[model samples]
Target: MTEILLPSDPEVRDRCARSMASKAFLTVWEGAVRSGKTVWALCAFALYATRSPDGDFLLSARTTATAETNCITGDYGLLSLFPGAEYRTVGNVRMVRFRTRQGEKRIHVVGASDIRSYMVIRGATFGGWLADEVNMHDRRFVSEALNRTAMSHDRRHMWTLNPDDPGHWIYSEYIDRYEAMDAGERAELGGFAHFWFRPSDNPAMTPAMLASLSRQYPEGTPFHTRYVLGMRCVAEGRVYPFFGPSCVAEPPEGVRAEFASIDFGSVHPTAMGWYGRSPDGAWWKVAEWGPTAEESARMTVADYMDVFERETERLGGIRRDRLTIDYGGGGEALVREAERRRWYPVNPDKSVLDGIQATAMVLSSGALRVSPSCRRTIDELSSYHWREGRGETVPDKVRDDFADETRYAVSTFIEPRIRRRRRWSRT
Candidate 1:
């Protein structure tokens, strides 16, 4: 068998070379877009296939669309690397077969959008597995793919991705885990080897390409981070992109109006925010109760009502006429409980998107103030994000619980007050 030399892109070639040489259970090649991470991972597998007889490998992406578009294992460029090899796509293009000097190599491509599809191949085995854009795939896919090869102690699982948000599972788990190992603070995951590079290392990137990228994407945007500097970006499903450490602000003294917005939950969390009206006619968030999970069994309607009452009192004062909450489900019963306790429990506005827009408007106008005490709310506001890849700034529904509730509360009460204040000033 002849050794196939990779392309002239040293960064891509080096990443491929590194993966080929690694002995760890997990070989990770992470970098920014256009840094040649994908090409390198595929090339390394191709080289391995030619050297190892009947080598069985797996190629996986977040979606079939991605698997087709990226064209890693089944594509021509990857196949072209191996000279005089017969390549064929089988089983609806899920698997790729190659007949070569080293023997027969099978590459299977799997698309996982949800956890159920990942469960199908639970007990399967493989020689190697390549997870592309790992940040985009479901976390369960990672667990399943890695475990499937558990029986093969020598099997290598490779992951390639760009930097993602701090909240992302990959960053928090894989990247952070590797960093801890390097710092001698943690034990390394057996057979795990991770490497990272960026677009700045790519000698193939020309000045014209940089200029074109600049023209195509806005400065400080995800495209700039992922493709230009090769930085990790926040996941697509985050809601509070604006919630971060930099946006912290002090709450004002002597509130004129105070209300609490409660979001009831059991598995997700039962969240609440205490708000106050400041002297400057701005709405200030004083505190929050959020992202909390039930430690034991499902929280009963009685338990939620109890928590709501406690949070309301902690906020200073909750007038029976001002307290609001998300509508539907057990909201009415909770409202009844609030009424019994002499705390207002009106239904908040229901539109998630409208509430998001309403809160954004308040923040943009500098009318929204967040107290240092409202750590969770503040964090949610800063870190909540959207899928920029689809060309929009809308918040992701999955992680926008607090933001949605804020919007609903603001739309129900604060928006009207702000509108009235604006109208009064004009008059």
Candidate 2:
């Protein structure tokens, strides 16, 4: 007979229970929406709380409402999985506490509206920490909440989150680095161990739920691909999936563009791409000139200045307010020197993903056109490949020089309002 009781799957429960007991620094459960990530998270911590002594467990979510709705407390009927537990509610504090016979475990369902709430975890030791929907949590939680556990021994931090694309902060910090490690990255032990599963991995899922999901979301849809299969498939990040060499743009004659972006490489060729906005609100990549044989022969700053002066004259006397440079080591000084020669020096706001997204939106919308003079930029954009596996692929360190330059190029000259934020603060 099928097990009709709540938390009926022993394998799922046992796997979660064992991971919590192992006290690994990071235990991630990447699963589909209905694959029982929440159930496994609670069962694991509750089971550990029952087995261990003098340790606390925290159940944190993006908000208190989600915490209550997701059944982190006994009121959600999920606590029925642990029949031997008693729940006490303190209405004044809006908190719920659970106790098992082996040892008492307190579950704090804290809301994260701001960074201040996370400060409470400082110097607080926990036997188990359950961060639900961790991807959706603010970026501040990592430095505040997780870092505070550095001094604790035998403590496990468990993450239960539905998979998001590469743009998310947690995916970049944890999952990205974990994948970058080589076979021998960890000595005497092994590489960081991670596990991913879907609702299909669990036999407990009902046929009705599967059919309902299929009917509600079509194949290839984000919801279906993300929530139903729990696969980390991000189609948006793969811009220009089928682009080829035919669409490369050529430089135009009678150039009136007054702005350019400079990527100064002292040893490498100092590179720059010139641009101008058309009447229809499209950006035209008019010219791209990097270190020629003559400019690359020397590493002196005067050599860079000479090349800059030539480009400035070639572009019909560049406006001193329109030049942008990468905020690299010693780049500010180069910009200052260029400014001394009456060329503008500018620096883009540092937002990698958002800036990339803005440039992509323009490119896909046909609002960005590349001139034939910018041949290397076009070639690099074409060859920029998405990293294999999942989440944000480490920008290829080798073949990504031109791609990186193009990203910086668009970030500097693309005057998109959404990408630019006006900062104002009250005194």
Candidate 3:
């Protein structure tokens, strides 16, 4: 026997209760991490299914794997979160077949990464729809998914996504544009509603944990702006909003380890960042050199190396082999130069999203900090943001040399160490 244990968070409860009682065609939950919105979504999905047992619902995510991980199978999985819930997948199809008060229910699972994925729902009709990471889906898929819904009055939708650049369609198309229109406009565009949340909304999160999480992202950083305060205030495209005053502390007195990260930018402005790791596992930006555009246009590998070595010495000395340079095609020359001089080649993790995500994760934990002197790094991170129109959000290539170098260094050096400690803690 399972029980539906909704969070006491009023916003979550009110939003979910609204979905259950209201006839609005769409209900969206947008907010910060651990806010219990997802739990609300699961409840709404189940309640909707029960009301129309003969109805078939459609559920999706960026991918089927993610759908399961985020909902059905993850630690806080929805399947087990509700009591007396039993489901069976329908054959080889992407659906979870179950029985509820209405009689028979089927919740179809699909991935909406591309337009082609829409074929999964082609010609079929849905009683309800639930989409996770809706922002990641192609517009065509989303449109098609909506079209596949059954015409019954019970048909409804629930969507969730983290905050992205304001330019994101989630804001322009859904939040303000599509919903909240006048009766005539909403009647023409379709009915919809939304709710907002933050980590503080989850009472299960202890005060100490919240403080630790708060420390990870100093105020004014994008992570803090979105995840902590739950405001859509971060500038549309800036990537590392976590590099401002709160994140910049005076150079710490005890730096347990030292290393350097280099992004070779001849003409584009090469960046070298000296980082120190303390016993507390925080990574600090101790020193950096991000030359002016004009200077980088002609600065040679040797010129940058001279500055790099001096910065290393000033930061209490890092082993020469630990000096890492980017090996991505654009930085090959620098990598070659470093190898020639016995320096380490920091193989750039080509997955731009992964590196950015890693950087954000570190910042959210307050483990990534910067020195006041590393103005270049701070400036770059402050402005680095996702570029729109690519069908995907990637950090704009411009004004990101130091940002890239810093992310590569942290993902390469700090994340691995953090993971090891986490693994050890379980034992």
Point out the higher-scoring one by TM-score: 2 or 3.
Answer: 3
**C-alpha positional error of residue 224 in candidate 2 after TM-score superposition, expressed in Å:** 13
Off by over 4 Å in 3: 6-15, 53-55, 74-76, 81-95, 100-104, 113-125, 150-153, 163-167, 184-190, 234-280, 284-396, 419-427
lDDT of predicted model 3: 0.72
TM-score, predicted candidate 2 vs. hidden true structure: 0.49
Residues 79-173 of candidate 1 have per-residue lDDT tens digits of 45554544455655566666776567777778875667677567777777778777777778777887777665356677788765656667776
Cα displacement (angstroms), candidate 1, residue 414, comes to 36
Worst 10 residues of 2 by lDDT: 418-427
TM-score of 3: 0.68
Please provide TM-scores, in order, for all candidate models, with all chains considered together: 0.51, 0.49, 0.68
Instruction: Give the runs in model 2 whose Cα sits over 4 Å from its true position.
Output: 1-231, 234-242, 245-247, 250-255, 342-344, 387-392, 418-427
Q: State the TM-score for model 1.
A: 0.51
- Candidate 3, residues 163-242, lDDT tens digits: the string is 66566666776676766588887665557777776776665678887776676554654556666766665344556654
RMSD of each: 13.7, 12.0, 6.0
